[model samples]
Target: MTVSRALSKPELVSEETRNRIEQAVRELGYVPNLAASALVTRRSGVVGALITTITNPILATTIEILQQGLSKAGLHMLIGETRFSPEEETKMLRAFLGRQLDGLILAYGYHTPETLALLQAARIPVVELWDLPEGDEPRTPVGQVVGFSNWAAGAAAGQHLVDCGYQRPAFFGYEDARENLRWQGFRQAVVEGLGIEPLRYNTSAIPHIDDGVAVIERYVRGELEFDGAFFTNDMPAIGALFTCQRNGIDVPGELGICGFGDLPIARVASPALTSVRVPAELVANTTVELLTQQIKAEGVGAMLNDVGSELIARESTARRSS
Candidate 1:
């Protein structure tokens, strides 16, 4: 009991006893079996996180911050990449829950019924990142959402382009739920704010820079016509910029482009790409705070925390000089 208490809740143990325990631990080089400890305490001291992909810098940055926050709280983080596959995500979810994780964080909210059932059976606190569902409907498997509204972010991007005097704009992105929401928002904003219906093109489930190049190539071939374009994320936006340069299409002069997730490359591009900035650090901190509360058995309820996004305008979307 003394050893268990000392290892699990050190603050409750006396300094002398703790010192003795430490000395013994060092001499014995004994490692505590976390699985065994979890059986007694019902706390795993670990959190499981599932992200669509780590290749995206935005998601990568969020995970990094979240890991740091969890470490500061003396907790370990186990991460899994879903590769945007529901089957893979379900497998990872089961695997993590089998390990008795204290909580779970998911970058994507879309899950199958079986996955949802597994999460419910686990009864652990879950946080969904990246985007929240529209309306007041609580369709999420987990009640806690930590991230900005992709719809709002998309609307902001559209409004910025409209304000920059771009009438015929197009949207380029994947057909995923999150990207669909962004496209819907952008299209709605462009139609209402500018009184013009924007063209849209959806690529594969996994978006790549090559997708952007292809979209631009279509435009160059007169297959698509638009004065401005909004990419779901920076990867395609940057690619489109490169394609435009290669095709001798003057940015912001002949065509304006904007992207979501203000990645680092946005600023360094030849014509800096305008983008919507999702507050990754804020999202991570808030997710950790909410998860901590949940792990402590504090009822956070169905809280939807929108960290918000900012529209960053740059040379890519600059208005033509009068």
Candidate 2:
């Protein structure tokens, strides 16, 4: 026990005892088996996170920040991508359970019925990212939540588009619960502000630069008539902007674009992007803090944090067409 104290919690053991333990470990060439130790201690020193996508730059940064925060707390992160599938998320979560992870983090607060059931039974410390909790539904098994309001962020983007005087605002993206919330919010705002339902180009494909380029290319070919649009995130907005330039359609003059996430590249892109800035870093740091607290707390402390978001108006949406 003293040897374990010396190795795991060095400050808890006296220097004299630690020195002897170190010498013994060296003389015996004893490599402490973490697997064996975990059985007794019930701490694997690893936290797992399930995400929808690994390719999204915004989510990628959030995961990086989360890893750093967990590392400081003496825990390593294990990440799993679900490719936006509830079944895949459930499978990954089951794998994490098998590893006996210290805690779990989920990208989305919502989950499949089976996933919610498993988490409810496992009783593991869990913190879901990207969206705030809707309720304590019998189906909602998440303990802590740290993220922004997807609906509100979307509404803000739509409202901004209306303010910028884009006559016909359109939304472009794929559908999932979270993204659909954004779409609903954007739709609500655009409809209320402009008294017209915004156009929607929904797809089953994942959001990508190529998809965006193709949308703009169609418009350039005189196929699509949307003069202004809001993309699910930055990729498509930038793609559209690029195509507009190639076709000589002036941004804000003939076309307006807005996106979410406010990725770093958005600020520097030609014509600059107007976007809804999600508090990704804050969410990551808070999720770590809340998750660590829940793991170590006497009572599985619960938190539902909404860091909120802001809409950044820029050149892309600066025009007020007369």
lDDT of each: 0.87, 0.84
Residue pairs in clash, model 2: none
Return the number of clashes found in candidate 1: 0
- lDDT tens digits, residues 100-131, model 2? 88899998776888888888888789888878
Clashing pairs in 1: none
Off-target runs (Cα >4 Å) in candidate 2 are 1-3, 13-31, 134-141, 298-302
Per-model TM values vs. the true structure: 0.91, 0.91
- Taking every candidate in turn, the Cα RMSD to the unseen true structure, in Å, is 2.3, 2.7
Off by over 4 Å in 1: 1-6, 11-29, 135-138, 298-302
